[model samples]
Target: MPVTKATDADFRQLLDQHEKVVVKYYADWCGNCRLFSPKFKRLSEAEPEVAFLDVNAESSPEARKLANVTNLPYFAVFRNGELLETLAASKEEAVVELISKLHAN
Candidate 1:
Protein backbone atom coordinates (compact mmCIF):
# COMPACT_ATOMS: atom_id res chain seq x y z
CA MET A 1 0.00 0.00 0.00
CA PRO A 2 1.00 3.59 -0.55
CA VAL A 3 2.11 5.62 2.41
CA THR A 4 -0.55 8.06 3.57
CA LYS A 5 0.34 11.53 4.76
CA ALA A 6 -1.28 12.11 8.10
CA THR A 7 -1.81 15.14 10.28
CA ASP A 8 -3.09 15.85 13.75
CA ALA A 9 -6.58 16.02 12.28
CA ASP A 10 -6.74 12.53 10.84
CA PHE A 11 -4.04 10.59 12.64
CA ARG A 12 -6.30 9.07 15.24
CA GLN A 13 -8.94 8.09 12.75
CA LEU A 14 -6.40 6.32 10.57
CA LEU A 15 -5.06 4.40 13.55
CA ASP A 16 -8.55 3.33 14.47
CA GLN A 17 -9.37 2.31 10.92
CA HIS A 18 -6.34 0.12 10.28
CA GLU A 19 -5.56 -3.06 12.18
CA LYS A 20 -1.80 -3.01 11.56
CA VAL A 21 -0.16 0.37 11.11
CA VAL A 22 3.38 1.69 10.78
CA VAL A 23 3.95 5.39 11.19
CA LYS A 24 7.06 7.26 10.10
CA TYR A 25 7.47 10.49 12.01
CA TYR A 26 9.65 13.03 10.29
CA ALA A 27 10.45 16.71 10.26
CA ASP A 28 10.80 18.77 7.08
CA TRP A 29 14.31 19.93 7.92
CA CYS A 30 15.66 16.61 9.11
CA GLY A 31 18.19 15.36 6.62
CA ASN A 32 17.86 11.72 7.58
CA CYS A 33 14.09 11.93 7.35
CA ARG A 34 14.32 13.23 3.80
CA LEU A 35 16.81 10.54 2.86
CA PHE A 36 14.66 7.73 4.21
CA SER A 37 11.44 8.76 2.50
CA PRO A 38 11.88 6.61 -0.57
CA LYS A 39 12.83 3.58 1.46
CA PHE A 40 9.76 4.00 3.61
CA LYS A 41 7.61 4.16 0.49
CA ARG A 42 9.20 1.01 -0.87
CA LEU A 43 8.59 -0.79 2.39
CA SER A 44 4.94 0.27 2.28
CA GLU A 45 4.58 -1.12 -1.21
CA ALA A 46 6.19 -4.38 -0.15
CA GLU A 47 3.77 -4.78 2.74
CA PRO A 48 0.39 -4.15 1.20
CA GLU A 49 -1.42 -5.58 4.20
CA VAL A 50 -0.02 -2.91 6.51
CA ALA A 51 -1.14 0.69 6.70
CA PHE A 52 1.83 3.01 6.27
CA LEU A 53 1.64 6.61 7.42
CA ASP A 54 3.90 9.62 7.14
CA VAL A 55 3.49 12.30 9.76
CA ASN A 56 5.47 15.46 10.28
CA ALA A 57 6.63 15.27 13.85
CA GLU A 58 6.92 19.01 14.07
CA SER A 59 3.30 19.50 13.08
CA SER A 60 1.44 16.45 14.31
CA PRO A 61 1.63 16.83 18.06
CA GLU A 62 -1.04 14.29 18.91
CA ALA A 63 0.41 11.59 16.74
CA ARG A 64 3.94 12.36 17.86
CA LYS A 65 2.91 12.13 21.48
CA LEU A 66 1.33 8.74 20.94
CA ALA A 67 4.68 7.29 19.91
CA ASN A 68 6.68 9.56 22.20
CA VAL A 69 8.66 10.66 19.17
CA THR A 70 11.99 12.16 20.19
CA ASN A 71 14.02 11.82 17.03
CA LEU A 72 13.75 12.31 13.32
CA PRO A 73 12.81 9.39 11.08
CA TYR A 74 11.14 7.70 14.02
CA PHE A 75 9.07 4.63 13.17
CA ALA A 76 6.22 3.30 15.30
CA VAL A 77 4.22 0.15 14.82
CA PHE A 78 0.66 -0.17 16.04
CA ARG A 79 -1.62 -3.17 16.21
CA ASN A 80 -5.32 -2.60 16.56
CA GLY A 81 -4.76 1.10 17.32
CA GLU A 82 -2.40 0.28 20.15
CA LEU A 83 1.29 1.07 20.04
CA LEU A 84 3.49 -2.01 19.94
CA GLU A 85 6.99 -0.81 19.13
CA THR A 86 8.94 2.31 18.23
CA LEU A 87 12.33 2.86 16.63
CA ALA A 88 14.36 5.93 15.71
CA ALA A 89 16.66 5.04 12.86
CA SER A 90 17.62 5.90 9.30
CA LYS A 91 18.55 2.36 8.30
CA GLU A 92 16.08 0.35 6.27
CA GLU A 93 16.94 -2.85 8.17
CA ALA A 94 15.95 -1.23 11.45
CA VAL A 95 12.69 0.01 10.04
CA VAL A 96 11.99 -3.40 8.58
CA GLU A 97 12.53 -4.98 11.96
CA LEU A 98 10.14 -2.53 13.54
CA ILE A 99 7.50 -3.37 10.96
CA SER A 100 8.05 -7.08 11.51
CA LYS A 101 6.85 -6.71 15.08
CA LEU A 102 3.34 -5.96 13.92
CA HIS A 103 2.99 -9.48 12.56
CA ALA A 104 4.91 -11.31 15.28
CA ASN A 105 2.73 -13.56 17.41
Candidate 2:
Protein backbone atom coordinates (compact mmCIF):
# COMPACT_ATOMS: atom_id res chain seq x y z
CA MET A 1 0.00 0.00 0.00
CA PRO A 2 1.08 3.54 -0.68
CA VAL A 3 1.68 5.86 2.23
CA THR A 4 -1.12 8.31 2.75
CA LYS A 5 -0.49 11.90 3.75
CA ALA A 6 -2.62 12.71 6.75
CA THR A 7 -3.53 15.85 8.62
CA ASP A 8 -5.34 16.81 11.80
CA ALA A 9 -8.55 16.75 9.82
CA ASP A 10 -8.39 13.12 8.64
CA PHE A 11 -5.96 11.42 10.97
CA ARG A 12 -8.56 10.05 13.36
CA GLN A 13 -10.75 8.79 10.57
CA LEU A 14 -7.87 6.93 8.93
CA LEU A 15 -6.98 5.32 12.24
CA ASP A 16 -10.54 4.23 12.72
CA GLN A 17 -10.73 2.85 9.22
CA HIS A 18 -7.66 0.65 9.24
CA GLU A 19 -7.08 -2.25 11.58
CA LYS A 20 -3.30 -2.00 11.49
CA VAL A 21 -1.71 1.40 10.99
CA VAL A 22 1.80 2.81 11.06
CA VAL A 23 2.20 6.55 11.21
CA LYS A 24 5.41 8.40 10.41
CA TYR A 25 5.44 11.80 12.05
CA TYR A 26 7.73 14.24 10.31
CA ALA A 27 8.55 17.93 10.09
CA ASP A 28 9.33 19.77 6.87
CA TRP A 29 12.69 21.01 8.12
CA CYS A 30 13.81 17.71 9.63
CA GLY A 31 16.54 16.33 7.41
CA ASN A 32 16.24 12.86 8.85
CA CYS A 33 12.55 12.84 8.12
CA ARG A 34 13.22 13.71 4.51
CA LEU A 35 15.91 11.10 4.28
CA PHE A 36 13.68 8.34 5.64
CA SER A 37 10.73 9.08 3.41
CA PRO A 38 11.70 6.62 0.68
CA LYS A 39 12.37 3.85 3.17
CA PHE A 40 9.01 4.42 4.77
CA LYS A 41 7.34 4.18 1.39
CA ARG A 42 9.17 0.97 0.58
CA LEU A 43 8.11 -0.50 3.90
CA SER A 44 4.53 0.41 3.17
CA GLU A 45 4.72 -1.33 -0.17
CA ALA A 46 6.18 -4.42 1.47
CA GLU A 47 3.36 -4.60 3.96
CA PRO A 48 0.31 -4.30 1.82
CA GLU A 49 -1.99 -5.21 4.66
CA VAL A 50 -0.92 -2.31 6.80
CA ALA A 51 -2.01 1.27 6.51
CA PHE A 52 0.89 3.69 6.27
CA LEU A 53 0.46 7.36 7.04
CA ASP A 54 2.64 10.41 6.86
CA VAL A 55 1.80 13.28 9.14
CA ASN A 56 3.63 16.54 9.66
CA ALA A 57 4.28 16.66 13.40
CA GLU A 58 4.53 20.43 13.32
CA SER A 59 1.11 20.81 11.78
CA SER A 60 -0.88 17.86 13.01
CA PRO A 61 -1.19 18.61 16.69
CA GLU A 62 -4.05 16.16 17.31
CA ALA A 63 -2.26 13.26 15.63
CA ARG A 64 1.08 14.16 17.15
CA LYS A 65 -0.48 14.09 20.64
CA LEU A 66 -1.71 10.53 20.14
CA ALA A 67 1.85 9.27 19.89
CA ASN A 68 3.39 11.99 22.04
CA VAL A 69 5.73 12.76 19.16
CA THR A 70 8.84 14.42 20.62
CA ASN A 71 11.30 13.81 17.81
CA LEU A 72 11.51 13.97 14.07
CA PRO A 73 10.86 10.82 12.01
CA TYR A 74 8.83 9.35 14.84
CA PHE A 75 6.91 6.19 14.12
CA ALA A 76 3.77 5.00 15.90
CA VAL A 77 1.97 1.72 15.34
CA PHE A 78 -1.72 1.45 16.00
CA ARG A 79 -4.00 -1.55 16.11
CA ASN A 80 -7.69 -0.92 15.80
CA GLY A 81 -7.27 2.77 16.33
CA GLU A 82 -5.38 2.22 19.59
CA LEU A 83 -1.72 3.13 19.93
CA LEU A 84 0.57 0.16 20.53
CA GLU A 85 4.09 1.57 20.42
CA THR A 86 6.18 4.49 19.19
CA LEU A 87 9.79 4.87 18.10
CA ALA A 88 11.86 7.88 17.22
CA ALA A 89 14.54 6.79 14.82
CA SER A 90 15.96 7.32 11.36
CA LYS A 91 17.11 3.75 10.82
CA GLU A 92 15.10 1.44 8.59
CA GLU A 93 15.77 -1.52 10.86
CA ALA A 94 14.18 0.25 13.79
CA VAL A 95 11.13 1.15 11.74
CA VAL A 96 10.86 -2.45 10.55
CA GLU A 97 10.87 -3.65 14.15
CA LEU A 98 8.12 -1.19 15.02
CA ILE A 99 6.02 -2.45 12.10
CA SER A 100 6.72 -6.05 13.08
CA LYS A 101 4.84 -5.42 16.28
CA LEU A 102 1.68 -4.99 14.27
CA HIS A 103 1.94 -8.50 12.88
CA ALA A 104 2.92 -9.91 16.25
CA ASN A 105 -0.59 -9.22 17.46
Query: How would you encode candidate 2's per-residue C-alpha lDDT over 1-104 as one tens digit per residue?
Result: 99999999999999999999999999999999999999999999999999999999998999999999988889999999999999999999999999999999
Q: Candidate 2 at 90: error in angstroms?
A: 0.4
TM-score, candidate 1, is 0.98
Q: Cα deviation in Å at residue 27, candidate 2?
A: 0.5
Question: Which stretches of model 2 miss by more than 4 angstroms?
Answer: none
Candidate topping lDDT: 2
Stretches of candidate 1 exceeding 4 Å from the true structure: none
Residue by residue across 22-76, what tens digits does model 1's lDDT show? 9999998999999999999999999999999999999889999999998888999
Overall lDDT per candidate, in order of appearance:
0.95, 0.96
lDDT of 2: 0.96
Task: Tally clashing residue pairs in candidate 2.
Answer: 0
- Give the clashing residue pairs of candidate 2, or none: none
Worst lDDT window (10 residues) for model 2? 96-105
| Per-candidate alpha-carbon RMSD to the true structure | 0.5, 0.5
